[model samples]
Target: MLYEGFESRESFDLLTVLKAFIRLLQKSPSSRIINVYGEMNEYDSDMKSWTKLFRDYSAKFELDKLMDQFYEEFTNTNIKISSAILGNDNNIQTIVEEADRIVHLAILPFNSSPKSKTMRILYGIVGEGMGRATRSKVTLEILLKEQHHVKVVVSNRAYKFLHDNFSKRFPSCDEASEGEAAIDIIKIEGLTMQYVNNVFDEKASVLHTMQRMPDMLNKNLDAYYKNLVSWMPQAVISDFDSFAYIFAKIHGLPILSIDNQHIVQRYVIPEEARESNPIAFYTYKCFVKAKLPRCNTIAVPPILRQSILDAKPLPVEHCEYFLVYQSSKSDTSLISVLQAFGEKCIIYELGREEKVDNLKFKDFSEHGFVDDLACAKGVFDNGGLSLMNEEVSLQRPFLSVPVENQYEQVLNAW
Candidate 1:
């Protein structure tokens, strides 16, 4: 769909689109579906080869045969579908002209913003974590500034974080007058991580997600389809969200993909680093590569907030505290570890919301965190790419203990 198979509730944006497309298909089985396969970015040499193979095969064989080959080589399950190859440039416009309705992925380009007199866009983002949401915020800001009518689908912590920020930044965007605003947010079901003894519990998390998935899927599908049919989008833009991707595939709509994960997929890993953990490294590389849709233009923009970019780093001598940022407040192990250092170093714990002991635990505020981080001696926390990047950008030492059983964090830490 947007990239590949649906993973979790984080991808509910994509799921909604897919459900809408299925409904359309059920109503009209004779619909002429023109699937357009997107090419991978130029930098991803390995994936580029696969793209070339698909392109060549599509050129040599019929649509059915090419789709069959695609399923055999790439996907685990067989999907009876046929597609045509369209060159990357202005693919969205082409799809809009041909298809009755369109759904596609969202990407924010610095040089050009989406402008249309006839196109209705549905933008999807994975909202389980803050990294995607943070990047989406910047993108949404640009879209709204350009006056693009975008319907945003998000869930879990991301929905609250985005809604709160948007409310403060654009007070006119309140539900009382959604039509007057350039953007509208729709809440959906999203996955929640499980933690045991302050570490991510993968098995428990998977079991919990599985248990709720059926109900979540049914409810979200119904809601998404109803919205999709009502809004009648002309295109879709996905940030590695599968529901949008699938919707585009089934309906033959133009889609664009944009995310930071592509940097990992495209960048050449050093031989030494690959050798260090060959299995993990390769697994992660393949996982990221497969997760994204094979789009013609895969834009990998730098993911950093303006605050992090503008804030000046403090001098090493003046830096005093060991700044701690935890996603969960329930994790006392991290608190205990930081507290052991006692008054030797001021332990500033930024978590959900609280105040305990010498550790100053509080809710996350962009300006407040940046101000504290500017004067921090070091950052102590789990391996989240956003914080790690900030610490490195500021030239501060980072001591990361990745959440257990979370391979993504483990890879980030490495």
Candidate 2:
């Protein structure tokens, strides 16, 4: 939506940009440091006279009140300003040094540039499957492309995956700082479900949480506060992760819930996905509903990797093998069944180091996995929404054996 001082749909003035920033800060009311820059060489008079230069410029342009609001709004952001003009002082260099955000104004005047935005965001991912990490990889890359500072709070395999993928590009990603690539990660204990003989064990799951939740939460708090107090995030994005949801609630941050699990809670379940076990489904649904129950949540569609879009899935007649994925690594019965079929099969997440018969047990890699999926005749999976979305996109046929008692997967199957 275009606001005032936006000459058209795309362009905005410097005063307008400052006003917008102030308005955004006022609305969100979080810790931040912003450095509004202009054409560097334009103010070439005296290095120490920027205050006087902008004061004269402000008077000529009649931008006193808006500038005042801008200065007043960000006074608590840690840099003290004694000079009224341009809101600069002896410590003006500190603004550039410690800025959490930077805005570049067009030189010579206004309305010459677009007012685009980025944010300091705390991203939280649930640490169970590869789906959340893979989806987060795409979004995180997008965020880094737009120069948004992101600090991910995650644990388990998700942490390992992200750390390995991002370690090269952002070598100093251990802390959230203002730069070309600013990313930090805090390892926190994430939820894990219990499986008994390939079936979701609700009692064991509840018991696991009851036994581990307190220590996990304590460790999470200790890790987050100890490592990231200065990394004040303006927003939070939760991949159906309870830690992020709770952290947002505690810190009064706005949450963007990005996951397919929210479908049954926020939207409706398909009639085709009718519950096989009504009591189990109800219990699981209640748990999902309680995880991040709130009035205000930003919903987004399921995030898919670029490879999913690029894949051109071949037909069963022309393909050589079948692809199988099991979230439950304990499901050895599936291995026996696939073996009995006496066909070449590719398997994932069985933690196997070698091939068994014709079953090719491979380690997880995004490119390799997508390549296999593109050539595979069919898929056998546990009804993860991510893989299902990929299947739909690639037009691949699949058999879904959803985890028992988890309504989200059950709903995804249909």
Candidate 3:
């Protein structure tokens, strides 16, 4: 039995884990998959929609009233979904006690620590950028392939993303399989940075998140403690997630930190490069040190899809058009800037769903973006480590606009 936690607010982070879990399930045909989640209100609007669909489908079929009949009708299918709201401590405890292993997303929780001997593995990720999530995906694939049971906990948009992908990847499973595992998805509140006109607004973001902390802590802590006590995990594998780092320390579990963020902390900067932005670099390094816990092992995973790794980069002059990636729908400034380049060169903008004359806008996609990037003349995006890594790997001319007050992005850009 396995309890997977996907408690992230960022969709990319959740997608990373979701893809890994789906691949794991597909490879391990005999494995039983159980997914657990929290209250519907905790999720963002998109995730709420999915939950509603699940509820509506259940209600329409009257599955609650006729579970036996429904099971009989869909007996040949491999996937089965059953949802319950944990309104009290008893319900939470019951689920925790039944699961043999836990897989958690890397965001840190506010609850106090507990002792446990269960084989628990965690994959934590930063909530702000997709780089951490991208790296975590590769790591999770490796972990699941090794057959280690884990509980994943994430929050924000990531939770919804992983939930949707899992549904799509494994629509059904074998009902008669004996070695079935339960996958639980627990959603909790995570900090999301506020933005003003596509630029990071640090003060407002902090205040906004701080305002919600009281209620988030009160509700999640109660459930967190109960679950930890019942399902004592043996180890944690974090990808720059603070909660898992703290939990590992409190419980004395061996933690392996795998992410590119650590490169700032552990890498040796050259003498000349260190002089470029001493204050910003020092401050950023300090912040990372404070957030991450000391781990038994620290590894920096590469952030690239198989397509990117396999393809050859075209020369700058030969490559046509500029590739742009931005997550916000409200930011029109970047569009205005790109328009200045004129209709002579095409601007391929990812993360925007529509197309506008000279600019070809497309929605954010892992495979699609890589294909575009492979043939682009230049790349323009916010200073996200994932994209930056790809830019460097492909040797593409790049321009990055780091979000104000997000020092990590600033440092990465530097």
For all candidates in order, the CA lDDT equals 0.58, 0.67, 0.55
Off by over 4 Å in 3: 1-119, 166-185, 226-228, 270-279, 296-301, 310-318, 327-332, 343-351
Per lDDT, the best of the predicted structures is: 2
In model 2, how large is the Cα lDDT of residue 337?
Answer: 95
Instruction: Estimate, for each residue in 92-189, the C-alpha lDDT of model 3 and write its tens digit.
Output: 45555434222221111212112312134654555554556555556555544444445555676666645553423322111111122223345656
**Candidate 1, 1-414: lDDT as tens digits:** 322332222345543554456445435323323344444222223556546544533332333322333333312221222233344336446655434222221111112212323234677777866777777777777666655556677777787878887755542211212123355566777678888766777678789988776556544553344344334455788876766666567556688776656655676666665676677667767777776646564455366778888999898678766787665455656667666767333333333465456567656666787888888888876787777878888888878877655556766677
Model 2 residue pairs with clashes:
none
**Regions of model 1 farther than 4 Å from truth:** 1-119, 167-181, 275-279, 296-301, 327-332, 343-357
Q: Please, what are the lDDT tens digits per residue for candidate 2 over residues 107-187? A: 111211123354668899998988888889899999888867688888888898998888667733323334456676668
Alpha carbon deviation, residue 370, candidate 2 (Å): 1.0
Residue 315 lDDT, candidate 1, scale 0-100: 87
Lowest-sum lDDT 10-residue window in model 1: 104-113
Residue 391's C-alpha lDDT in candidate 1? 84
Q: Which number leads on TM-score?
A: 2
Better lDDT candidate (1, 3):
1
